[model samples]
Target: MGGLTTAAILSDLGRKVCVLEQHYTAGGFTHSYERAGYEWDVGVHYIGEVGAATRTRKMFDYLSNGQLEWAPMADEYDRFYVGDKVFNAVAGKDEFRNNLIRQFPNETQAIDLYMRLLDRTGDALSAFGMGRGMSKLQRFAMKPWTAWKLRGAFRRITYDVLSDLTDDQDLIATLCGQWGDMGMPPRRSPFMAHAMIARHYLYGGYYPVGGSWRMAETIIPKIQAAGGEVFTYAKVEKILVENGRVAGVEMKDGHRIRCDCIISSAGVDNTFSHLLPEDVAIKSGYRQRLTSVTPSMAHLGVYIGLKGTAEELGLPKTNFWIYPGNNYDKAVDAFMDNPDAPFPVVYISFPSAKDPDYENRHPGTATIEIVAPAPYERFEKWREETWGKRGDDYEALKEALGSRLMETLYDKLPHLRGKVDYYEVSTPLSTNWFGGYQRGELYGLEHSQQRLKQDWLRPKTTIPGLWLTGQDVLTAGVTGAMMAGLITTMSMVGARKMGPLLRRIYA
Candidate 1:
C-alpha cells in the first residue's frame, strides 16, 4: 500500500512512476489469494476511519479515482474476550465511551480521562506525522513545539500511563485489548501508539467493497492513466548506489532500471540489511543503527473455508480478540519464553461477514482467518527450505499449529467444527516466501517506545537520492502506510506544490 500510494500520488502529480512488485500479484499485504474456490485477504482485515468522507476516505478516493469503495462493519466492530469476560467497542465515540462505562461503572473517571488523552494525542500524532516530512532545519526549528505536544503521552509507556489512570488490571487490559493492531503489548508500546489506534477506530471498521485486492486493482488504473506501470514478479536483486546516491535497481534476472531518485517501501531493514551494499550501510551508520530496533512479532495464519455462506454460518462482522488472561505483558512474556504456553493473543476475523460482496464472488462459501504470534526461532531451522517442499517434519509442525488454531476457532464458534471444507496454516516462513520479510515479520519493525522515538525513521533518508516509506516510516496498518506515502510525496515535492495538491484532494 505504501508503494502503491506513493506511485499513485506521484502519478497524479504527473510524475510517471514504476512499481516493481516481486510477488506474482501486487498490493503487498493488501493482496488476496485463492484456493479450492475460496479467497482470503492476507494482511488487510478491517480498516477504520473510512466510513465517511474523512481524510482517509478522501485519500482513497483520490488514489483510486473514486473507484474504491467501503462497506461498514457492524456497529460493534471489535469484540474482546479477556479470559472469561467479554467486552466490546461500538462505532460512535459516545457509544464507545458509554459501552466502556457500562462495562466498568466504577472506572468512569478513568475512562473519561483516557478519552481526553486520546483526543489530545490526536494533535500530537498530527504533529509527529508532519515532522516526518520536514527537513532537519524545519524539525529543529519546530522541536520545542513538537516536544511539548508529544511530551507526556508520546514519551510514556502505555501500561504506565493507563496504570496512572486506574489500578484495575482488567480495565487496563480492556483498553489495551487492541494492542495487537500495533503488534506490541502495553508495557512495551508507547501510549501514543495505543491512542492513535484507539482513536482511529473510534468511529468503526470498514472493509473494501469487493476485496482487499481491489485496493491495488483500483489504484493501478490511476498509475496507468498517467503512463506509469505496476510490474508484478519484478524481483529487485539490489539497489544500485553510485557515490552515495541511488543509481537504480538491479533485478534478480540481471536487468537494471536506472533512476536517480528512489523511494523504498520495501522496509528499513530490507533496504539497509539486504538491498544496500555492506559498505554503504556501514558508512551510513545504518549497520549499527539497525541494532536499536528489532523485527516485529512473526505470526501463524489459519485460513479456513466453510461450506456455508457467512450469513448461513452465523458469522459476525465483529473481529474477535481472544486473550488467555488480562496481563497482556505477562502472557506475552510467558508465551515468548515457552512455546507450549497458551497464545497471548489470538485475533480472528470473519472476512466474508465484513465484505458485503463476498457471497457474489464465492457463492455459499465463508472464509475465516485466525492470527496468533509465533516466534521466528520455531521455524528458523527450515528457513532455508523451499516453500511447499519443506519436508514432512515441517508440514507436521504446521498441521499441529493449524489444528490448535482451529480448536481456538471452534471454541468460540462451536457450530462450525464439522462444516469446514478446507484449511491451511502459514508460518513465518510463508511470510518470507510471499511478503519477502526475511524474518517473516508481521509488521516491519516493532512499535516499541524506543523505536517510535527514532528521528531517522522517516521518508527522507540521510542517503542522497534515497527515501524510505511504508509501515516502518510511520506506524503500521494500511492507512499508516498510505499516510507515509503522502508524507513521502510531500517531502519529495516541496510544501509549496503539495499544499495545493492536498487542498485539491482533501478540500
Candidate 2:
C-alpha cells in the first residue's frame, strides 16, 4: 500500500510512475475476493487515526483525490469476551475508560493510568507523524525526547501494559482485545504500537466505505491522473541497478521499465536480500541486526460465507475476541508442536456487521473471518505448491481446522452453527503466496521495542536510489502502512525536506 499510495502521490505530483505487484491483484492484505456471492477482507480488522483532521484521514483524502469516505464501526464499536464476562470497547476515550471501569469498579486507578498512557503515547506519535519527519541532526537532538516519552511505553511491551493496568487476568486478556493486529503476544510488542491502536479504537474503529479495496482503488485513479499506471499481473523480477544505484526494474517477462528512482514496499529482506544487490546493502550492521530479529506473528484465517447478515443471525455487529481463560502465551507455542492443537485465541468479525447495505453488495450474504496465531512451520508440508493454490493435505488440514474453529465460534455464539453457507481456510502458505511474505510471515517485522527503536530500518537503504517502505518501517496495519507511504515518499525526496512536507500533510 505504501508503494501504491506513494506512486499515486508522486504521480500526482507529475512524476511518471508504474507499480509492480507480484500478485494478480492490488492491495496486499487489504485485497478482497468474491466467492459464491460473498466477499471477504484478508486483513483490515478495523482502522484507526481516521477521524476528521486525523493524520491518516488527511493522507487518505490527499491520495484518493478526496473521494474516499470512512465508515465508523456500528454501535458498540468492539466487544471483549473474557470467559463469559463481556466488556464494551466504546469509541470516545473517556467513554471507553469509563466502560472498562464500570466492569471492574475496584480498579478505577488502574483505568486512570491506562488512559494516561494512551493519551501520552498519542501525543508523541502526533508529534512524530505530523511534526516534520525529523532530520538527522534534529533526530539526534530528538532522540532523548523520543526515549524519554517511550521509556516506559515501548520498553515493556503491551503485555506488561495490560498486566500493569489490571491484575484481573481475565480483564488483562480483555483489554488486549485486538492483539491480532500485531501477531505477537503483547509481551514482545512495543507499547507505542499497542497504544496507537488503543487510541484508534478509543475513537472507536472505523472501516472504509465500498470495501477496504477502495483504499487502493481510490488512489489508483490519482496515479493515472498524475500520468502513471497501476496494473494487475505486472510482476517485478528484480530492481534494475546502475552504478550501484536503482535505474529501473526488470519484469518477469524480461521487460525493463526505467525510472529515476525505485521505492519498494516489498519489505526489508525481500527489498535488500532479493531485489537490491547484497554486496552494496546499506547498513550492514542493520541487516545483521534484522537477521537476528524475530518475526511478529503469522495468522491462520478461516473465511466463511455466511447465509445471512450477523443481525439476522442475532449476532452483534461488534467483533468477539475469544481466548482461553488461562495460560495465554503458550497458545502460540502449542501450534508449532501441533498444527491441530486447540486454538486458545481466536477473533471473529462479520464485515457486513457495520453496514446493513452490505447485503446490497452481496444480497442475503455476509463474510466473517476467524483468525489465530499460526507458526509458519505448520504449513511446511504444503509449501511446495504456488502460493494461494492449496493441495490435498492443505484442503484436509483447512477443513479440519475450519470445522474445529466453527465449533469454537459456536461455543461463543451458537446461532452461527447453521449460518455459514460457504467456507474456506487460509494458512500461512496462502499468505506466503499471495502476500509475498517470507515463510508466510505476517506483520512485516515483529513488533518489538528492539525492532521499533532501531533507526536503521527507516526508508533509506545502503544501495543508492533504492528505498524500503510498507509495514517494515511502520508497524503493520492500515494507518501505519499509510504513514509508511508518507515517510518513504519523504525519503525518496530526501530526508532533509521531510519536515516541510509533513507540516503540509498535517496542515
Candidate 3:
C-alpha cells in the first residue's frame, strides 16, 4: 500500500517512479490469493472513512482514478466478544457513543470524554504528520507549539490515560478491544496510536469492492500512465551507497537500477539491517537507533473456504473480535509466557459478506479469515525451509495451531462446523516468505510509547536521496501507510511542489 500509493502520487507529480515487489504479485498486504477455487485477502479486512468524500476517500478516488469502489460493512461493523458478553461498535459518531453508553449506561461521562479525546487526536495527528514533513529548522521553530498541541493523551500510554478517565476495567477492555489492529495491548500502546485507530473507524467501515487487490490493480494504471511501472520479482538485494549517500539498488538478479532518489517501503529493519551496507548503517547512527524499537508480534492466519453463498453459510458482515476475557494485557502476558494459554485476541472477518461483488466473482463460495498473534519463535526453526516444502514437522505444527483456531470459530458459529470445504494455516514464517519481513513482524515496528516517540521514524533520512514510507513511517493500517506515502511525497517534493497536487486531491 505504501509503495503503490507513493508511486501513484509521484507519478501524478510528473516524476517517473518504479515500484518493485519481490513477490510474484503486487500490493504488499493488499494482495489477494486463490486456493482451492476460493479467494482471500491477506491483510486488508476493512477500512474507514472511504464511504464518503473524506480525505482518505478522496485520495483513494484520485489514486485509483475513481475506478476502485467500496462496500460499506454493516452499521454494527465490529462486534466484540469479551468472554461470554457481547458489545458492538455502531456507525456514526452519535450512534457509536450512544451504543457504548447503552452497553455501559453508568459510564456515559467517560465515553463522552473519550469521544472528545478522539476529536483532539485528529488535530494532533495532523500536526504530527506536518511535523514529520517539516524541515529541521521548521520543526525547531515550532517545538513549543508542537509540544503543546501533542500534550495530554498523545504522549501517555493508552491504559494509563483510560484508567484515569474511568475505573471500569471492563469498559477499558471493551474500548481497547481493537488493540490487535495496532498489534499492541492497551498497556503497551501509546494513546495517540490507539486514538488514530479509534477515530479512523468512528464513522463506519468499508471494504474495497471485488477484492483488496483492486486497490493495486486500479492505482497501478496511474503510475503507468505517468511513465512509471510496477514490477514483480524485482527484488532489491542491497541498497547501493557511495560517498555516504544512496546511489541505487542492486537486484537479486545481479542487475542494478540507478536513480537519484529511492524510497524504501520494505521497512526500517530491512532497509538498515539487510539492504544497506553495515558500515554505512553504523556510521549513520541508524543501527544504533534501531535498537530502541522492537519488532511487532507476528501472527497466524487461517483461511477457510466454504461451499455456499455468504448468506447460506450464515456469515456476518460484522467483524468478530473475540477475547479470552476483559483483561487484554494480562491475557497477552499469559499467552506470551505459555503458548498453550488462550489467545489474547482472535479476529474473524467475513470477506464475502462485506464485499458486495464477491458472489459475482466466485459464484458459489464464501471465505473466512481468522487472525491471532503468534510468537515468531515457534516458527523460527523452519525459517530457512522452502515455503510449501517446509517439512512434515512444520506442517504438523501448523495443523495443530489451525485446529485450535478452528475450535474458536466453531465455538462462535457452530452451524458451519462441518460446512467448511477447505482450510489452510499460515504461520509467522509465511509472513517472512511472502512479505519479506525477516522477523515476521506484523506491523513493521511496534507502536509502543518509545517507538512512537522516535523522531527518526519518518520519511526523510540523514542519507540524502533516500527516504522511507510505510507503516513504520507513520502508524499502522492501510490508511496509516497511505498517509505515510503522502507525507513522504510532501517531504521529498517540498511543500511548494506538492501544493498543486494537494489541491487537486482535496478539491
TM-score per candidate, chains pooled: 0.99, 0.93, 0.99
Q: What local lDDT score does residue 477 receive in model 1, on the 0 to 100 scale?
A: 94
TM-score pick, better of 2 and 3: 3
Q: Please identify model 3 stretches exceeding 4 Å from their true place.
A: none
- Model 3 local distance difference test score: 0.92
lDDT of each: 0.93, 0.74, 0.92
Instruction: List, residue by residue over 346-419, the lDDT tens digit for candidate 3.
Output: 99999999889999999899999999999999989889999999999999999999999999999999999889
For model 1, residues 331-438, the per-residue Cα lDDT tens digits are: 999999998799999999999999999999999999999999999999999999988999999999999999988999999999998999999999999999999898
How far does residue 338 in candidate 1 sit from its true spot (Å)? 1.0
Off by over 4 Å in 2: 126-135, 161-165, 282-287, 387-390, 494-507
Scanning candidate 2 in windows of ten residues, the lowest lDDT window is 126-135
Model 2 misses residue 84 by how many Å? 3.9
Model 2 lDDT tens row, 124-230? 76554532344577678777776676566656667777786677765666567676667666665677777776777777777777787877888888788867888
